[model samples]
Target: MKKSQALYRSVLIIILCGVGFMYSQSESVYQQVEEAVANSISKGVQVGQEALPIQLETLKGEQVSLDDYLGQPVVVNFFATWCHPCQEEMPIIVEMEKRLKEKGAAFVAVNMTSQESSKDEIAPFLQHYRATFDPLLDKDGEIMKKYQIIGIPTTLVIDENGIIVQRINGGLTFELMEDLVIFRE
Candidate 1:
């Protein structure tokens, strides 16, 4: 009976130790997420801040406004036709857009029209990437300046209430894209 009691106590200690280790690991993960969110909030346009208004025309000459998407989560991407990183990430962005559409998220691509050599370059770039969504044209780069976009291929995830939730400075991967839109709080 004494030996059995000692074995039970040892097993109990092992289980308690395992639980403590798991809890510590979860706490570490939580801390990392908190830090990442805090850092993202300090960048351009700022997270938790209401998005700057954008009203621009699409390649087909249709006027689109950010206000139009106010009640839905929006993914706003600022890109130029000539940007290499933008070119590489275009397909991934397009795929993410489709995936998030069912959940009522609107994906808006703002082309830095002023940065393009000619308007002609836009069509071929979109065609090559097979991006079916029409991109809004920032004709005078006024929208870009409003958002303080210093880099190409910058993407912002705005929540349903028009607040900027996440701002990505570079190209996106599928996993990051999922985290930004689908899995985020």
Candidate 2:
């Protein structure tokens, strides 16, 4: 009986230790996420770097490649229709794109994987929000992962050579993105 009791207590201790280790690892992960988000929110460097080609599925189920826009300045923002910050910035984004139309910039909104939304649901959401820019549906988050996106409303400004000049992690204003996209004086 004594030996059996010792074995049970040892097993219980091992289980508790395992649980504690798991909790610690989880906390570390959260900290890393927070730090990453913080770094993204800070003033982003004008990276002046080229981006690798990545393909995404369009809302119509056709494959779209970023390389297709290689010669133009592309502004890509990752968002969700249900995301309020995303909604709040749509008007600004639309205005920015409109104001800088002659600069050959492409302002694109890539919607996140929304379990509750289909292409049908997205149409009304786009119209209701006055989002003039066509929002591509990231149905499987494959595109999102390509960019290592960890937060909603992340915007990337790719230069004419397919280089990612700016990576803005948070919401951006029309004025701000316009400057990044180089709206002509």
Error of 1 at 166 (Å): 0.6
Q: How does candidate 1 score on lDDT?
A: 0.87
Q: Pick the candidate with the highest lDDT.
A: 1
Q: Summarize candidate 1's per-residue lDDT along 36-141 as a digit string, tens digits.
A: 8766654237787878888988999999999999888899989998899998898898897787787778899999999999988999898988888899998898
Give candidate 2 misplaced runs (Cα > 4 Å).
1-46, 114-119
Q: Return the lDDT, model 2, position 128.
A: 81
lDDT of each: 0.87, 0.72
Cα-based RMSD of the predictions, in order? 10.2, 16.9
Superposed by TM-score, candidate 1 places the C-alpha of residue 70 at a distance from the truth, in angstroms, of: 1.1
Query: Worst lDDT window (10 residues) for model 1?
Result: 37-46
